[model samples]
Target: MPQPGATSRILVTGGAGFIGSHFVRSLFSGAYPGLAGSRVTVLDKLTYAGNPANLDPVRDQPGFAFVEGDITDAGLVDSLLADHDAVVHFAAESHVDRSITGAADFVVTNVVGTQTLLDAAHRREIGPFVHVSTDEVYGSIAEGSWPETDPLAPNSPYSASKASSDLIALAYHRTHGLDVRVTRCSNNYGPYQFPEKVIPLFITNLLDGGKVPLYGDGLNIRDWLHVDDHCQGIALVLEKGRAGEVYNIGGGTEITNKELTDRLLSACGATWDSVDYVEDRKGHDRRYSVDWRKINAELGYEPRHDFESGLAETVAWYRDNRAWWEPLKQRAGLA
Candidate 1:
């Protein structure tokens, strides 16, 4: 796999999602080394989470372009891969609760859609199809952090679908020698996140004098990575990551749901007086922590923001830009 040098033509799938959209901004803003003036074409399906506002910052940038489409569409994928040199795939069915209610869409969007992208990349001779995965694929961890070599034991339909896609990406690399890289990232919270997730849910509920719904005693633990840090890691992989390798992106912030919600309430200037404990969802993982030694040593990557600072910045952004997420909340039936 060739190192993605400065200004390489790249295709980013799902560039409209919370994480993917951040990745697109990083590209145009030149957040990573050797990426200035790089051309990025985002192929998105415009799912509920895909908002054009996410790409508002990059629409007119000289190196940025977007196409509203699904990755599973073989014809469109082939045509795009034929033009770009590298791919950063972030498109998938990501919400665990949605996946629990119905796994069918997750199966189609993650497994089949990734396969379509791989096939197109192979046919078009595209290099470095960076398949984005999730830490949930490794299941629950008690004390130790999960490494890239950890055996996958995904517990939720969302994680299972992502694991399935990661395997397909690796298979394409070994079987056909296509340059494919994989990244498994932990929980992400920042601006532009869909309100269905924990952060936005609690923030909006508090703002509206609604009860903060807590699931399953709120003990589920997850590492929270700022979207910008996640984007930086993805850019590093796209630019210098070794082929057929899996890098873990993490925030190094370990907190349980209960504790996290507490912080969120404080950020919103609310108290625990208005909380609702909801029935725990089935198969919720106990914890997730990424061992970033691989990407750290290889790419010299470390998260730029600490938890407190990042969370404060995140809270401030949401507070300042309620207009950006208010429509999403209403559309999702949260408002």
Candidate 2:
């Protein structure tokens, strides 16, 4: 906890990525009231998914700073961890398809890098360490949603690495009494998301008059939480959550790929023909959903925007804010 009238330095790892960048933005925007006395330090490697432009808007803000570094560098992490009151770990190799092609990167970064951070936290930083995780760690579910205590049954290499990190984090908390709080959030969609992800990939394709690729008959269901809502859940855990507990954050709406593609068409003024169904990638999970009762009951949390409204808002952002995303598209050859 931060002392009153003192600016708590909040160190965020992988802070340039999708959800991590949003959390960085939310903190400076006063979205977390308890963090009024907080400053931010983002340590990121600026990988393909890590965009410095996302944080460019807040770079000049008095309380914000950034460094280009890898979390696997234990010496560097330890040196940096010595200065903060909290650690929000959002850095990971998150794409499942990419993981199938290259499991080694996932294991190295998601597993080894996280262990490096946890070791640093236990050795140097006694502040709250919020591990940002994904619901994929619970693997696939045929029907009912997964609670936090559910067994780890990750299917993809990406999810397997995340599960390994979660286990390491939990052990550090239980064995060493380090303050560790974990959050497993559902699929996230919003502005500044990399185009490789489903929503952005399809939306950018639609905007560019190209076909939107639909994987595996487009029936896989996912719970889409806006990045803002995810950032809110993370802040709550860091501020008010008890150590050694897991919380689930969700978007609260279940939509299959086909249904979501239809909605995206409506938003983008495109049609079903614009979607080109493609072969499913290896290890694509059938469905992912989170039961958010724990976060709501424990932290008084509620997502601010509903799916429909957020979808429209996100579409509009991509349309109007092309200046922000266009360069990224060009660099990625999506243009």
Candidate 3:
């Protein structure tokens, strides 16, 4: 696998979305020392979750470009890959509830789109393709944490599609010998996240004196990782991860949904009166935890943001950036 340097030309899919935009901004801002001067071309479909404003902070940085396009377009992907040395794939339909209601989009974007990108990368001889993935691919873990070696047992259509993409990505490395590295990360919460996601949704709702729905008993547990830390782990993987290997990135903080809701309520100056218990999501995982020791030992990856402080900061961001999210919520009919 070829290593990326300052002069490397990298393609980032879904760079207008929350996590992808953060990565692009970090790249241009020199957050990743190994990729300080790397050139970046972002190919995004500008889906509902993908807000162009997310990249506004670094839009004019030298060596940065953005192309509005879909990854499923084989010709487009191929043409773009020809100019890039590596790829960091983040495009996917990731909302579990939305996937349950309609799964075809998830399959097309997560599976077919991934296959299309991988094929293009292989043809273009692009090395070190980093596939960003989720820990939900392991399904519900009752106890302990899932290591990178765990068999994928995805429960939701969204996770299933992501799992399929993960396998397809690895298969390319195994059979065609593409330089593919996969990173499975825990739940992410931070600024610039679309309001449809849990953290932002709840924050925005509560800010408007609206009620938040707590599914089932709200006992479902999830490990939360700040977007910054998640991106840090990804940068480490892109810089030093071994090809064909999977790494789990965790924040080392586990909290039940009910507990999380309580914290959110407090953060937003709301009481339990603002909470409404709702039916649980179909096939909702009971808990999710990832063993991130592999990345820590291999790439010196460790989450820098504490959960309490991270959550508080996230709430503050949504509160302060209503101009950024209000229109998004109205456009998505989520308000």
- The candidate scoring highest on TM-score is 3
What order do you get sorting by TM-score, best first? 3, 1, 2
TM-score each candidate: 0.98, 0.97, 0.99
- lDDT for model 3 comes to 0.94
Q: What does candidate 2's lDDT look like per residue over 208-279, in tens digits?
A: 778888898888999999999989998889888889999999989899999999998988889888977789
List runs of model 3 lying over 4 Å from the truth: none
Q: How well is each residue in 204-282 modelled by candidate 1, as lDDT tens digits?
A: 7787778888988899898999988888998888878988899999989999999998898898899889788999988
Q: Which stretches of model 1 miss by more than 4 angstroms?
A: none
lDDT of each: 0.89, 0.88, 0.94
Query: Model 3 clash tally?
Result: 0
Worst 10 residues of 1 by lDDT: 1-10
Which has the better lDDT: candidate 2, or candidate 3? 3
The alpha-carbon deviation from the true structure for residue 54 of candidate 1, after best TM-score superposition, in angstroms, is 0.9
Evaluated at residue 295, the lDDT of candidate 2 is 95
For candidate 3, list the clashing residue pairs, or say none.
Answer: none
Candidate 3 lDDT, 50-80, residue by residue in tens: 9899999988888999999999999999999
